[model samples]
Target chain A: MKKPEPVGAVKHRRDTVLSAIVSQIPYIRFLGVSFDRHGDELTATMAYHPDLIGNPMLPALHGGATASFLEITAIVGLTWASLWEDMEAGNIDVGTVQQGALLLPKTIDFTVDYLRAGLPRDAYARAVLNRSGRRYASVHVEGWQDNRQRLFAQATGHFLMPPRDAKH
Target chain B: MEDLADGMAVISMPYDEALIGDPVTKVIHGGAVSALMDTAGGAAVMAHPRAGVGTATLDLRIDYMRSATPGQRITATATCYHVTRSVAFVRATACDEDGDLPVATATGAFTVIPGKSKT
Candidate 1:
């Protein structure tokens, strides 16, 4: 357990850990969320599918899907911050594992405004960090289809961060 | 009937059996209405062929004007009004088949992502 081998020493560790965790999340995988880093922003995109349809008469996108997208974005934002901070502290190895634990303990207090009706077409969402602290973070996420805005969801979530076990 | 329009969609269902509460005999599930609003708004955004891959709803707020009737056909329409670099804003309304008055209204924000397929 040599102090988890310093963060810098595990440059690709965050990605590996995230990939593994994301792979096991069926709903997320089904949503086809792909992650990319742009400076401080982390973006997630998913294609529209029939499975996410809410109303058969209208064949529109489901609000649950929209909420799910927002939730995932919030999780990613928190994880991103955790990983970034760990890397800065040269303690990256614990970031992912710690993130997984925190994610399980996190709760969402989301507020959404249904501005417009979404089509049966594809859609995507992006989460932006509004603020972040030691135990909590707030994010403003938006979802779109074609080039228009379909849903706006935001939340401030609190995550319990505990130190990794001695095994790490 | 006017073509579904760019950001418009219709929903007609039995309110009696579909709803959950007794106080409101013809109670439309809030979730169901929200879903309809999302679809309409999403479609409005995707109306343009050149639009990006797809969009996802970030948040939605709905205000119920009045409860709908049981076994009645309801229509919902959503339109995307503004779109910034990464954010899209939309507004919507739901009503019965006659289109006389709105049963509910909603507003939402959506984020557009590049390289994704439209739903």
Candidate 2:
């Protein structure tokens, strides 16, 4: 058997596959959700555009647009975290991380609280995995624009994942 | 000049490439569904008897009952359930051509600005 690639190498491959999957998502593509890593956390950024306005009066970002951005961020964060955790535990078979990320988790539920109207500007969101159980994962996500101290929205979502032992 | 019914609105969106979440599966993205529901909810608020000059979404909860079928128009019908001094409650369901089952359902609260703000 060929030698297994290093975890770093596997991660690079996984990122490429995952990014491609995310890009193919039409809404994500239209909204321009981009991912970046700072230290150890991932941040999702959405560029402001005129098409995202729902209320022409305040010229605010559509509530659905904000909610969707947070939701996508949380889902993507969970996917990466799950893959990495599985790999670190040696539970993930070699050459399967990419496939794992491709199999997007099914969203079980989503809730969003619009704290304030999102202005017409670039928006950012960060998601934290609160709990990763055997069959389900929960994530909390917050979105902000212009100033990080003032959040535009907050959301929580649950997604269905396969059991730890199940094949990807 | 035509008059529309009160507290009721319907929004229809076709399944296009821009709404697809998975190109391979050709399924509509959940976010697009949420946007559709939100827009419909806002429209209902606009048509309400007690509609304020303006409104904003306060909270929304969405349940994805199923993925919308590929290449089918998805429509959301929203009705304002109640309106108080400061809030309006709206519930909506999105469905494709597949009978009575809904692709998704959402319940949301909207902030009703009783009158136009002078600011």
Candidate 3:
């Protein structure tokens, strides 16, 4: 008989899922991405650095960087959801999982629209999972700068999830 | 961007630990590949027949077929396929050293900046 899971336990489980995916991505660390979780929602913050600037005239954050950031957010969100599902089904234990317990999600296709120049400052992104199936997941993501109301980019992507034992 | 023959611009990204998407598999992140392709697309606009014009990415779409082999030089080449008064269409491919098949293919449009008359 499984007992009712408390809110804290659920949050902790989600954090484990998020970290498991985030820790594997070297580019995420290179860009200084920090994650924040509130009630089940995850948002990523990218710290500004000189190496990320593309347009020296405007001293703006590279558009490519903005797109990548938002895309990563989407992938992370979906990976978290997938892991959580695995936990609920009693398939895997989040605590004792090894580094390669889950295969990295592969991007099938991605589209990015640059709404405006990414200014030289911290950028924030959040991904909304649109749909998830056995083999594929679709996500919509957006990125904003200082003001959340103003968007810097919008992206939509599809990711392919291979079987656990299959090689990507 | 390094100039290649036939009006192509190429950008090379070294394989480094900082680019790995999966530490266990050592796969390069899709974002890094996207960035490299985007940069190549913008460079293609700069190397267009009507050079000396600044351009910004309007939209970029990438289709990833496979993971870039780890510990190999990733290179992206961009070619400007079409040009209009206000927009330039570019296509790019990112591949590893083997170069038999592209890891990803990208198509993008860029806003063209007017340059001073060469006359």
TM-score of each: 0.48, 0.87, 0.90
CA deviation > 4 Å runs, candidate 3? A1-7, A88-91, A164-168, B4-7, B115-119
RMSD of 1: 12.8
Ranking by lDDT: 3, 2, 1
Give the docking tier of candidate 1.
incorrect
What are the clashing pairs of model 3?
Answer: none
DockQ rank order: 3, 2, 1
> Which candidate wins on lDDT?
3
The most accurate candidate by DockQ is: 3
State the displacement of the C-alpha of residue B76, model 2, in Å, after optimal TM-score superposition.
0.4
Predicted candidate 3 versus true structure: per-residue lDDT over A1-168, tens digit per residue: 978888787777767767767876878998788788776688999999898998887777776787779878987787776666566555666654545556767899899999888888899999898998878888999899889999989999999976655521
Better of 2 and 3 by lDDT: 3
Q: Quality of candidate 2's docking, in CAPRI categories? A: medium
Question: Distance (Å) between predicted and true CA of B47, model 2?
Answer: 0.5
Q: Give, for candidate 3 chain A, the lowest lDDT window spanning 10 residues.
A: A93-102
